[model samples]
Target: MSKKFFEERGDQSAVKAEIIQKYFATWANIILPTAQRYGGGKIAYIDLYAGPGRYKDGAASTPLLVLQKAIENPSLSGALVALFNDMDVNNTQTLQSEIDALLGIEKLKYKPEVNCNAVDHDAEEYFATTKLIPSFTFLDPFGYKGLSLRLVNGVIKDWGCDCVFFFNYNRISLGISNPMVQSHMAALFGDDRAAELRKNVEGVKPALREQMILEELTQALTEMGGKFVLPFRFRNDKGRLTHHLVFVSKSFKGYATMKGIMASASSKADQGVASFAYSPADSSMPLLFELTRPLDDLEGLLKKEYAGRTVSMLDIYESHSVGRPYLSKNYKDVLKKLEDAGDVSVVDPDGKPRRSNSFADRLMVSFPKVKK
Candidate 1:
């Protein structure tokens, strides 16, 4: 609940706002329906850093966007329980007012069975005491102090939950080597590992150090029981590193779904960066991009994974696609290319040549015999 400089400054047209909103909306669009379909009972949406529900220029905030997404998806019409927490009482009140206004609209497309609550409290405290439930919790604190690895691990261990959090890369990079911040960093990472990494990266270039820290953070989350941890970096208008949006999930399916959503939101300007921006006023060609692994890389990776061993397509998909950058389609394409090149042979379970448009789960893949 540390004060965000921007929150006090009251700047509405922040470029990063658009980027965060788009990513949140994309995640909501997919997660809400998926949760409704799979989650047996009511699903919760928790926004830990819930701010005022709109910008001065009328841009919808994350809380409002999440509620709108739930309302739009008829499948989740009455099953959403939203919890909005902000340390600022004024911000909580403002957000509550916005939620009231939206719910009061009589002609709205759908009436949400939403049990919305806005609370003025620290996110860390609230998360620690709340009863565990099937939920998607968003932890977007302005700084890095409020989130601890133990708190997040507890949530995943206690409930069916997925988390999308903002890791303040800028703040962490600046304070990493400072002894004053060592305890905080250790708490955030759940161990003294951050200190060790800080020592190792002491003289590394800023950009390379940032990457190293991010990789270490990803590894930490995975060790804390995250089945998948994907980090998407955001840059400022000056092209400086800003923050990273990190998604942690307990299931491979959830991981794949989040990866696809992130891939779709990637900025076309820099194909390598996953940042994006959207303006309602602009009329231009929509930016579109997809995450793709080079076929050669995929081929080599597949060979390394199953080189001389025979395996099933399902085995490959389950082993490689879920937590990795590549998708199931990438696996299929690479396998097909390998088969065409005579590097591998595709056969049905009975050892007959497989002749199907799509690779079946049970189809066996065999590498070519190596002659002495």
Candidate 2:
């Protein structure tokens, strides 16, 4: 974590906190019952690069936010296992103090663990060796050094484990080219792929280069068994891409849940589709939604891809929504349009046209066969 970040609680920081806290509440609620019923009642919240619990202006950071939430929720008070680590001793000390001073902290069944430890190769080895419980890990390393694919894989290897990591675009975009950071880049994308990434990104436009780099990162994660990887972008006050908070999971439910959360926090949306980004620089601009629904493009994609197929709405959403910006609602809306225009048929279980007004996931959607 950067010291400059704690100078004041910026808008980006607030949005980041909102995204994490909001999702944690839902995540805990969904997993808590199952975890208590069968498995160990422990759901972990691991923050690998947790900073001091508060910004200089007295606004609470993530550790405090999480603790406060846990204190409020009776089910989570004893069931949640929190482990917060920071490389800086001062930060760990401060975080310990903050945790101690928090109201109702003593009521938590499992006390929060605060540690001063560097998140490095040794740390990665520990995570790989330890069997983590169902966890929502937040890996917000200061730089690209500790943000390796192995570390990510280690944390998310268990069932119900998911991760949201800070990807410093500015650091990585430049670091990929610097010989000094070659080892770090290799750790992130593997040796051969890192070389290829560097070679491919040379002299490309900034936008294209960013996309290519992210593609490589996404590819690396998927290869490591991270099937669902979602990115939420943050732009600086000047509209320059500064950072990305990437959510990675293997479950469709987690992916869908995050899409809704990220969509709500989006800076711009078009035709009910979310950009999944936060841009303070665009504060003066009005919402980017077009009055006319130009869902022809999405409709065309669905028509061509799913022609001659009959699938449930959930299946369609799970299969097509990942790696695309469209949400379940977006897909439902587009499918409704296609159905209205006679391009496709949506039906109930008995194969008749759907009668309900609600676009339920259980309904079957049948794309028309291609005309001869």
**Best model number under lDDT:** 2
Give every collision pair in model 2: none
Question: Each model's TM-score?
Answer: 0.77, 0.95
Worst 10 residues of 1 by lDDT: 274-283
lDDT of 2 at 214: 92
Give a tens-digit lDDT track for model 1, residues 24-56: 455455556656576654666777677777765
125-237 per-residue lDDT for model 2 (tens digits):
99888998899999887777688999999999988898999999999999999999999999999898899999999999998998999999999999998999999999876
Error of 2 at 156 (Å): 0.2
Clashes of each: 0, 0
Deviating ranges (above 4 Å) for candidate 1: 1-40, 103-131, 237-239, 268-293, 349-357, 360-362, 369-372
Candidate 2 TM-score to native: 0.95
Per-model C-alpha lDDT, please?
Answer: 0.65, 0.88
